[model samples]
Target: MRLAGNLLLAVLVLAALAIAATYWRAGQREAAARAAYPPLGQILDVGGVQVHAHVTGAGPDIVLIHGAGGSLRDFTFDLAARLSDRYRVIAFDRPGHGHTDAADTAGRRFDAPRQQAALLQAAARQLDIARPLVVGHSFGGSVALAWALEQPGDTAGVVLLAGATMPWPGTLNASYRINSSLLGGALVVPAITAWVPLPYARQVLAGIFAPQPMPESYPAEFGLPMALRRGLLRANARQVNGLRPHVVEMSGDYPGLEIPVELLHGDADEIVPLHVHSGPLSALLPDAVLTVLPGVGHMPHHAMPDHVTAAVDRVAERAGLR
Candidate 1:
C-alpha cells in the first residue's frame, strides 16, 4: 500500500511540473513576438480609451475594422497604401485588441456590436467624420452592422467580409471559456506568453487558415505581440459562448436597417460557416447584397484582396459614395 501511494504521488508531481513547463514555453513565445513587432506611431483616444488607429487617404471617411484576434495593422499595414489615394481610410485597433486599451472599463460592455457602435460614434465625433462608410471583416462585420443600426441616419453604408451577423451554430467550448476567464486569465495567459513562443502559436493559427499559407507576418502581427494577445483573450472572455445574447438581441434589428449593406463571404469558410452567416444574413437584411466567393475561406479579404477590393468599389458605387 505504501509503495502504491508513493507511485501515485510521484505521478501527480510530474503532471504538475509538466503543466507548468508547458505554460512557461508559451509565455516565452509571446514575449519574442512582441519584441519583434513594436507598435507604429499615432493612437487616438476615443471615449477615454487609447485606440491605435492609422489614418491616410483624402476623400470621404472609411473605417476598417479587423476581425477576432486581429489588430488595426491587419487592414492598414499592408493595404492602407493602396486605398489612401482614393479615400480617407482609417483602421483602428478595436478595444481589447492591438495597441488599444485592453479593458474599456468606462463602457463596461463586452458585446461586439455595442462596443462597435460606441467606437464609431466616438471616432466620428473625435475625427469629425460625417457619416463615414464602414467595412468590417469577420467579427468586425458584426461591429459594423451594429454601428449602422445604432446610428442608421448617420451611416453612408457598410461592407461585411465573412462577418458573424446572424447567430452561428456551435456551443462555446471549454477551452475558449477557460482562456477568457478572468480568474485564470492573469496566470494562464502570462504563463503561456512566457514559454510556448510565437512560432508555435503561429503554427496553431496556421491550422485555421487551411489551404493558404499563414501570412508571413502573422506571428509578429497576431501572436508575438503580447498586448494584442492579452486584448484578444479578454475580448473573447467577455463574449464567451459566442455573444449569442447580443446576436439574439440584434437579430430583429437587421431587417429594419435603412443604409446600404453588402456582405462578402467565402463558400469554403469553416470558422464562421457560410451557412450560418452569409446565407441567412443576406436573406434577412432588407437591402443586403451578398457576394459569395467560390473555393474561398474565412479570410478571403486577406487571401484575395483584389476580388474583395473590387466588391468594395461596387458597394461604393451602389451607395452613391463614389
Candidate 2:
C-alpha cells in the first residue's frame, strides 16, 4: 500500500512540475515576443477591443488586411510602403492577431469572419476611412467579403489575394483542430508557444508559399515572435478551425454582392486552391474579375506585388476612385 501511494505521489509531483514549467516558459515567451515586436501602429479603442491600425501616405484610402497568423507588418514590410506612394494605405492587425485584442474574451464566438469585419468596420469609421478600397490576403479575403456585404455603402472595392471563400473539402488542419479546442488551448497551446522552434515555423511558412520563394527577410521582418505568442496562437487556431462553416453560410450570399471585386490567384497555389475559391466566387458575383497568375503560388502580394497593385488600381478605376 505504501509503495503504491509513493508512486502516485511521484506522478503528481512530476505533473505539477510540468505545469509550472509550462506557465513559466509561456510568460517568458510572451514577454520576449512583446519586446522583440512592439506595436508599429496606433491602437484605437473600438468598442470592446483595441485595434492596431498603421496609416501611411496620402491619396485614395486603401485598407489592407493580412492573412491568418499575420499582422500589419506583413503589408508594411514592402507592399503597403509601395502602395503608399499612390494611395493612403492603412494596414490593420486583425482582432486577436498582432497587437489587437480578441473581440470576444471567451475566444469562441468571434471566430467568424463577419464578426471580425464588424470590428474592423467600427475601427475604420473612427479613423475616417470613408468608402475605402479594401485588400485582403488569404483569410483576410473572407473578412473583406464580409465587410463589403455588411457595409456596402462604406466599401468602394475589394481585392482578394488567394482568399479563402468557398467551402473546401477536408477537416481543419490537425494543428488548428488541436490548438483550438478547450483542453488543448488551455494546456497544449502554452507548451507550443514556449517550445516551437524557429526553423520549424519557417519550414511551415515556406510550404504555404511553395512554388514561389518567400522573401529572404520575411520571417524576421514580419515579426514571427509576435505570431507565436500564446493568446494569438489560440485565437488564430480557433478562427481557422471554425472558418469552414462560416464560409459555407457566407458563400450563399455572394450572388447578391454588388461591389466591384478583383481576385488575383496563383495556378500553383497549394495552400488555398485556386479552383475551389476564387474561381467559383468570380462566377457567382456579378461584378467580379479573376486574374490567374501563371506560375505563382499563394503569396501573390510578395511573389507578384506588381500584379496585386495593378489589381487594386483596376478596382479603384472601376469604383471611379482613381
Candidate 3:
C-alpha cells in the first residue's frame, strides 16, 4: 500500500512539472511573437479599449474586418492595397483577436458580434470615418451585419464576403466545441499554444481554403505565429464556439436594418457553407445582393478580389457614397 501511494505521488509530481513547463513555453512563444511582429498600424484608444487600425489611400472610406483567427494583416496582405487607390481603406483588428482589446464585460461578451461591432464602431468614430462601406469576411461578416444593424445611419452600406449570417443547424467542429468549453479553455488551450508548432497553421489553413490554392505569401504575412499565442487561441475558440446564439439573436433584428448589403460567397466553401448561410441570408435582407462564385472556396475575397471589389463599387453607387 505504501509503495503504491508513493508511485501515484511520483506520477502526479511529474505531470505537474510537465504542465508548468508547457505554460512557461507558451509565455515565451507569445513574447517572441509580439517582439517579432509589432503592430503594423496605429493602436487607437477607443473608450478604454485599444484598437489597431491600419489606414491607407484616400477616398470614400471602406472598413475591412478580417475573419476568425487572424489579424488586420489578412487585409493588408493584398486587398486593402488593391482597393487603396479607389477608396480610403481602413482594416481593423477585431477585439480579442489581434491587438484590439476585448470588451471588459463579463460572460465573455467579446464573442458577441454586437459587442465587437460596437467596439470597432467607436474606433471608426475616432477616425471620423464618414458613412464608410463596411466589408467583412467569414466570421467578420457577422460583425459587419451587426455594424449595420446597430447603427444603420452611420453606415453607408455593407459587403459580406462569405459571411456567417444565419444560425446553422448543427454544432461547430470538435476543436471549437472543446476549446470553447470552460474546462478546455482553462486547460487545453495553454498546452496547445506551448507545444503546437507554428508550421501547423498551414494544415488548418488548408481546410479554410480547400478548393482554392492558398497564396504562397499568406501564412507569414497573416501573422500566424501571433495568432498561436495563448490569449488569441482562447479568444478565437470561444468566439467561434459560442457564435450560434449570437447569430440567432442578430437574425431576429435583421428585418430592422435598412442599409444596402452586398454579399459575395463561394459555392464551394465548406467553412461556412454557402447554402447554410448566404443562401438563406439573402431572403431575409430587403436590399441584399448576393453573387455566388461558382468554384471558389470560403475566402472569396482572396480567391476573387475583382468580383469582391465590384460588389463594393455597387454598394457605393447604391448608397450614393461614390
Candidate 4:
C-alpha cells in the first residue's frame, strides 16, 4: 500500500513539473519572438479590432492578406517591395493574426468573409485604396475568395496563392485542430508558444515552404506578442473551425464571380493540399486562370516570387492597369 501511494505521489509531482516546465518555456520563447520582430508602424482600428497594416507604392491599389497564423509582414516584406514600385501595395493583418486585435469570437466575431470584405472596404476608405486587386495566401486566400464572392462586382481582381478555397481535408483531425488553437494562436497559445519554441509547429510551417529554407525572420514574422498570442490562437482556431462552413457557404456562389481571378499554387504543396484546394477552386471560378509551379510548396509567393509577380502583372494587364 505504501509503495502504491508513493508511486501515485511521484506521478503527481512529475505532472506538476511538466506543466511548470511548459509554462516557463512558453514565457522564454514569447519574449524571444517579440524582441526579434519589432512592430513597424501604427495600428488602425477596423471593425472593432485594431489591425496592423503598411502601405507603399502608387497607381492601382492592391491589398495583400497573409495566411492563417501569418502577419502583414509575410507579404509586405519581400513581395510588397517588388510590387509596390508600380502598384500601391497594402498589407494588413487580419482580425486575429499579426498585430490585429483579437477581441472577438471566430464565428460571431469577424467571420472570414465579413471581416475581410469589411476590412478592405474600411481600409480603402481610410487609406484611399480604390478598387484594389486583392491577393491572399492560405486561409487569407479563402477570405479573398469570400470577399470577391460576397461583393460580386466590387473587386477589380483576386490572386489566390495556395488558397484554401474548398472544404478542408479530413486529415486535419481533432488534436491538430486543437493544437492549431492551443499551441499556435491567441493569448494562451502565444503565451505558451512565446516560451516553448514549438519546433513541430515551426516544422509544419516550414514544410509548407518545403524545398525552401525556413525564412530567417520566420519567428519574428509569425510569433505573436505574449500579450496577443492567445488572441492569435483563438482567431486561428476560429478560422479553421469555421473553414468548412465558410467553404460551403462560398462554393455555390464561386461560379458567379465576375471579377478577373488568378490562382498561383505550388504543385507540391502539402499543408492545404493542392489537389483538394486549388484544383476545385480553379474549376469553380469562371474567369479564373491557374498557374502551377512544379517544385514549389504552399508559399509560392516566397518560393516562386518571379512567377508570382508575372502572374500579378498579368492580372493587372487584364484589369487594364498595366
What overall lDDT goes with each candidate model? 0.73, 0.90, 0.88, 0.74
lDDT of 3 by residue, 200-292 (tens): 877787668879889887888887788888778778988988889999999998877888999899999988989999999998888989899
lDDT of 1 by residue, 1-322 (tens): 9999999999999978876775666556556656775666466776576767778889877888877777777776466666778888888777677667655666565456676668656866777777778889877888888888888888888989988778766686675677677766766665655554556766767765665676886655553455435446767566545567778788888889877787888888988888898889888888788888887888877677777777667767777879
Best by lDDT: 2
Cα lDDT for residue 197, model 4?
47
Q: Which ten residues in a row have the lowest lDDT in candidate 1?
A: 222-231
Residue-wise C-alpha lDDT for candidate 2, range 17-68, written one tens digit per residue: 9988998998998898899988898999876578899999999999999999
- lDDT for each residue of candidate 4 in 159-180, tens digit (9 for 90 to 100): 9999888886564656336645
Collision pairs in model 2 = none
Stretches off by above 4 angstroms in model 1 are 1-35, 105-110, 221-223, 240-242
Consecutive 10-residue window with the lowest summed lDDT within model 4: 182-191
TM-score of 2: 0.97
Ordering by lDDT:
2, 3, 4, 1
Badly placed stretches (over 4 Å) of model 2 are 104-109
